[model samples]
Target: MERKTKLALAKTATLLAAIPALVYANASGPDPGLTGVPNEAGTCAACHGSGTSSINTKGGSVTVALPNGNSYVPGQAQHLVVTVADPTAKRWGFQLTARVAAGTSTQAGGFKSTDSNTQGICSNSQLRTAQPNTSGTCAASVPLMYVEHTTSGTRLGTTGSVTYGFDWTPPSTDAGKITLYVAANAANGNNQDDTGDHVYTATYSLTAATAAAQPTISAVVNGATFAAGIEAGSWVTIQGKNLTTAASCDAGSPRPGCRTWSSSDFTNGTPTSLDNVSVSIGGKAAFVYYISPTQINVQAPDINAGDVAVTVTNGNGTSNSVTVTAADFAPGFFQTGRYAIATHQDGSLVAPASVIPGASPAARGETVILWGTGFGPVSPSVVAGQTSSQAIGSALAYASAPPNITIGGVTATTVGAALNPSALGLYQIAVTVPNGAQSGDQPIIANSAGKTSPANVLFSVR
Candidate 1:
């Protein structure tokens, strides 16, 4: 078993070594290239000139004079175009095909691609005998050397060249071959039929690879989250296993590699454009970017109302989803004398908390306690209707103020305004029964920000 394994390994290595480095310009055809009779003489010059050749092919013939070449690169969208001549049939035409080898055709075996070709077209034929009138375009999938586009004089012309070649990313080997055939038909001006086996051979080999790999996409993360109210031009951080990775893409590709976290990548991948409020971060390998993934930092991007979601794709077979909300995120509630209001974690007043106890309008003294969180400092305030004229202490005095205060509907007069240090978490503003003030589940408003304790001051004036 060990000996057999060694032999197999040896065979594989030998096979790979036989493969050439490149293929493109190393075509096995005419020396310099046999596009027409004038090009044929150039083949002989290779032996004379620096790197020239005199291999040429015209009507009814196909020629290749190179000694070595390499495989065709695939993603590069590489391809070839050739013209052949079929001099036989009363009406003559030609067929074209391709053959690919792993090595210099001498060492490793070759494989024939069976894909459709777009380069196969008739150059000269009986059907095209009217000088430049060629019919039918012959296309095939490449990586293979086989005869096709066998046009009859009735459907084609003679005396011209049949063009064929390849289109694909050539493999990383050299032993590749592209062969062509010329066939004539009865309609050909020659007035005779050409056999099926008529063909011309041109073989060349190249060494090592002159190309590189195709753009391969990769991501480090799989998804991200977005806050509501998409702010245009914000770089929404996206995480995925390959989000930061860069794909080289094809050389012939119109789109070059995208910036690591470009919006184009996400928009192009998905039919719809990325939400204006979001975008991906850029990098390579385990890519990284800043976008809210989980609990938002208190100092980080502000939270908004409504839910938002994001989808991140690595473009290499993986993706995931992220969710967000529009509701303001708060750590605690606000104080309004047991009647509280909703505020965001940033401590800004939000939804007003409904007054409870459901009592009818009151006209005298009453007390109210505000409840919630983050009441760092107590601020002075006044109701919409009453001004300094409704005096009752530092809380609210009408300068011997006659009007009092209203505590959640029950009117009252300020007994005293309790002022505590900013650090104090709670306070008790007390008031006495008073007249002239009326209310129905009305609120005891404040004039300052961040004040929550000692809800309302009440007083009385008989």
Candidate 2:
């Protein structure tokens, strides 16, 4: 019995050896550039449909699902899935490419395979090859890239439909618009030839997301009082939309909090722009200090008193010019809510202890320093956009005229009134609290150059 079995096996081996080996084309992967992209050969149908006009038959469909609807943010990555479906299909495969909508031959972004079921192809105008690395990046000379199925991705003889997933990163800058071209095959699983397969082609158009609206100025006001009007060398606050691009602290960005211009942001002079955000007042750039989406703090440039056009320019575009009255002196006191921002000689804050942690009310007869802006020009006038610098004892850059300051309706003795030497557009006033000053919140007002500080401001006194 053993000898008979050996003879049968030998006869079977001889019969197999006598037959020709069957070769299957595209069993590993299709050649490059078959995604039906513009200027490319017709989809897999060029090789899979037996030269018949039956390609793109009605029984099946190819679709691409994008995570971000029909718009893409520049430099953002999106996961995508390609699905090929046919009720009678027993195998599936697909290929896809993204091209700039303006010029279909130009690549729009990059595609990378997310799993073993897929692979990437890099192609030049004339030739194509497998991507050299997992990043799916192509050589600079070969700028076009495509993503398609690997051999195992075919799922031969096991499916009525199949889906492949990959990731696509949009260009770092807006590319206008983009289109994805995809071609898919739903095969019969015969493995003998490409005759009985269905070919499908689809294209998806995506637009660059509309950018944040250009900055819009709703109001231009004193940075200290939030009142309208501005003055040269004054701290001005621009109230607007889309003033800056930094995300707020609550927006989940990876910084400590909202962006504030730091010392490093200055160069030879104060930065006139921050994070590509700039302000032009009367056609002169303002020195930018703090920036946020809804507000910007800037030191107004030196300009004559008159109506001037104010505008903000940022990454998106320029805002509509808003006219604002510019004056030589628009005096304002920096305040914490209704309380004037004041400090004792030792630098401790003067406020209701409950208003600020570790704060105490100012004592009668004590000398308190008050902070403000827009006191107008001083002697040895400091250049706009430059830091204020003056020797403390040599000569003080005092206001053109000593400001008349009254607290609780009683005129206080003003000892010092000048621009703070260590800062720009900032002024400090030294005053002696009245001997008979009443306790609790006291109205504080400063009048300079005939302009009065906002009337509602007050300070805590005891």
Q: Report the alpha-carbon TM-score of model 1 versus the true structure.
A: 0.27
lDDT digits (tens) for residues 114-139 of candidate 2: 99888877878874454434685677
Best by lDDT: 2
Per-residue lDDT for 109-189 in model 1, tens only? 222223332222222211221111122222222112222322221233433444444443333354344322222111233
TM-score of each: 0.27, 0.56
Model 2 clashes, total count: 0
Identify the runs in model 2 with alpha carbons over 4 angstroms from their true place: 1-208, 250-257, 390-394
Model 1 segments beyond 4 Å from truth?
A: 1-81, 85-155, 158-162, 165-462
In candidate 1, what residue range of length 10 has the lowest lDDT sum?
291-300
lDDT, candidate 1, at 379: 33
